[model samples]
Target: MHQYVFSGLRVSSEFKFTIADCEPFDGSPDVTIRFVQYLEKPLHPIFADEIVTAAPNDVWFCASGDLAYRVKDGSEILIQRGENVPDADVNLYLVGTGFGVLCLQRDLIPFHCSAVEYNGHAVAFSGESGVGKSTLAAALSQLGYGHVCDDVCIANSAQTPMRVQPMPKGLKLWDDAAAQLNIAQGARVSADLDFHKSYVNVDRADQTGGLMFNRIYILDNDIAPEFSIHELKGAEKHAELRRAIYREEWLHFLQEPRKTFDLVSTLASKVAVFAFKRPDDLSRIKESAKFLALHFDDGDAE
Candidate 1:
């Protein structure tokens, strides 16, 4: 059996993983991932089909021709690998998206963000799909920022600084972004045969539990000629947090609205949130990274 501690949970799995940082859990794992030949259909009606069907207690997800996964009671995963996908492909979705669902069902705050640990705290970039959250995280890592996590960010919001977990899969980059950035990233790990998503390795930097979250930037896709930052407050900040939840469609069924509100408000009260309006030009992506590096530089944070 293969085992690792991920996102603050002790996870034991039946398959090897290509994650950046994986260590054996001294204690018994909180989540157990078993590999099986097949899974029976849910007894109850599925919440939805095609993508994910989430019941009050269980969540089931499938990839077109690779694997099918069922997440149960926020504590266990049943993965059925199809003949079509390689082992790495099966593990790709299992750890990335599948585990994110586990966090949501467990009532932990999971955000669609890529975070980097810098100086003494975590800095995260959240944005719409195709807006380069992973790209920015990659840039930061190349610049010597310790990687915290990617794609799906898990947080222990109950803490004062909202401790961020290291998902530790490194940066998943598309072909275009990889070409544009010019960083000598490791070999690409295929996410799906049908889709071109790829992952590049970032060497491990973890704190066992997590790192303190200091600031989050929502990379607004709103069209603009120039880049700008808008600091958000009160309701706006909470709204952004709500919107940032990875695969938020599961939230309606898995959690109460009031609990989510309190979680968002508490985090907002502690960490800073900003809406960063990025311009339409793709060439300027590096410029945006430079802006962040300079802005968060030692003297500038204060």
Candidate 2:
């Protein structure tokens, strides 16, 4: 079994993972992942769609082709691997949507963001898909910033200072971005033969202990030629943060509004939220990263 620490939980898996930075652990795992030859979907699902079928405390995620998964009770996962699917592709969904629901079941908030270490703490960037969260983080890394986590920032808001569990899986980027930035590609991440998506290794922060998460920047597109930053306040900030929840459609199946709201409210109150707007041009990513790096150094947001 592969043993490692992920999102503050001990994980033992039957499959090898390509994504690195998960520190190995020897203790009994909090979550166990088993590979099965065949697994069935939930009998009576509260939610069903082309991608997923969900029941209370149980969810079946369907990836492309024959790849499917069953996440249960926040403690175990049974994977039905596709015969021809690459392990890297299977791990993509396993660490993305599958672990997202697992975090919710474990009462942890999985904020959909790409984070970098700033001033000894975590500053996360969040936004809709294709908003360049990963690319911007990669850009900032080129400016000497350290990558903290990607895709999901596992947050424990119940704590006094809102700690984040580090789960850095390198930087996943599109082929165009990788080639444009001259980033070294690691592995092919597509299952359905879309070869554009792949992983790129970069400098990372130390994940020895917990890190306090204090800032979040919601990325927005701007028609202007320069970058801009605006602070969000009151209900707008709260609403924007709510929309950052990963796999939010599965919230209905989790069904813990009071708990969820409490967590969200605590996060909004603890972390500073801002609207960061930049041009959509990829060639200007370094300029945008320099703008953000100066902002971090100046401590302008704080």
Candidate 3:
């Protein structure tokens, strides 16, 4: 029997898997997986034959003709097919694909951002792909900033004060960026990459404390060359944040738009948002980080 823990959740099972059938390990106690009976469902049009959805728990386990069990909340929920999971210190589950959903039903507001810590506060960089999200995060880490999460970040806004969770160590970067970071050759990128992607870790410097989010920079290609910050306000700001909210890879469960909308709206109201743009020059990425640190520090003086 093999046991895996994630976010303090434990899963024990007696099963063996080959090297070709393993998935990337995520240490979380909220999930426990074991092989089980084989069941099939209609495949989604977009994902085609690669994925399937299950009833009852609505948890989408990877489909591979093998059965697996996931134990949570003291209840054994069967995961049709998946990989070996690990024990995690923080318990936040990214529910569906392309959207942010918290496994816990607490009153916390979860935001979709790549968060890092600088001078004890969490600064989240929220934006779309090709917008240099990971690049900016890596630049900050190289300059003494601490990393919390590169792509996905979870926050507990329901508490008396908001708190951010530590994302899995490492940032996924493009091939060019990987070369700049000097990752080993032929290293596998994230599981979903086909051409240009790689992972880089910044924890070698200093790893400690989840920084409270003090600033937000929404990346856009249409802005001026210089770095500027804006305070998000009103319904317009809320709408932008909703559009920027991160989506999970398993988005089939979130077929209902209302569920997605309500969840994202609640997250945006809790944090400050800013618009960030870059010129042909890439140096602005670092400038943006320093701009944020200085601006926040000045605000503290007032």
Highest TM-score model number: 2
Runs in model 2 with CA error above 4 Å?
21-24, 300-302
lDDT of 2 at 90: 81
Instruction: Quote each prediction's TM-score.
Output: 0.90, 0.93, 0.66
Instruction: Compute the lDDT of residue 143 as modeled in candidate 2.
Output: 81
Where does the lowest 10-residue lDDT sum fall in candidate 3? 89-98
Cα lDDT tens digits, model 1, 184-231, are 555456744565567676644556667777688999888888777868
Ranking by lDDT: 2, 1, 3
**Candidate 3: lDDT over CA atoms?**
0.51
Give the higher-TM-score candidate: 2 or 3: 2
lDDT of each: 0.76, 0.83, 0.51
Clashes of 3: 30
Model 2 clashing-pair count: 0
Q: Is candidate 1 or candidate 2 better by TM-score?
A: 2
Regions more than 4 Å wrong, model 1: 20-22, 191-194, 202-208, 298-302
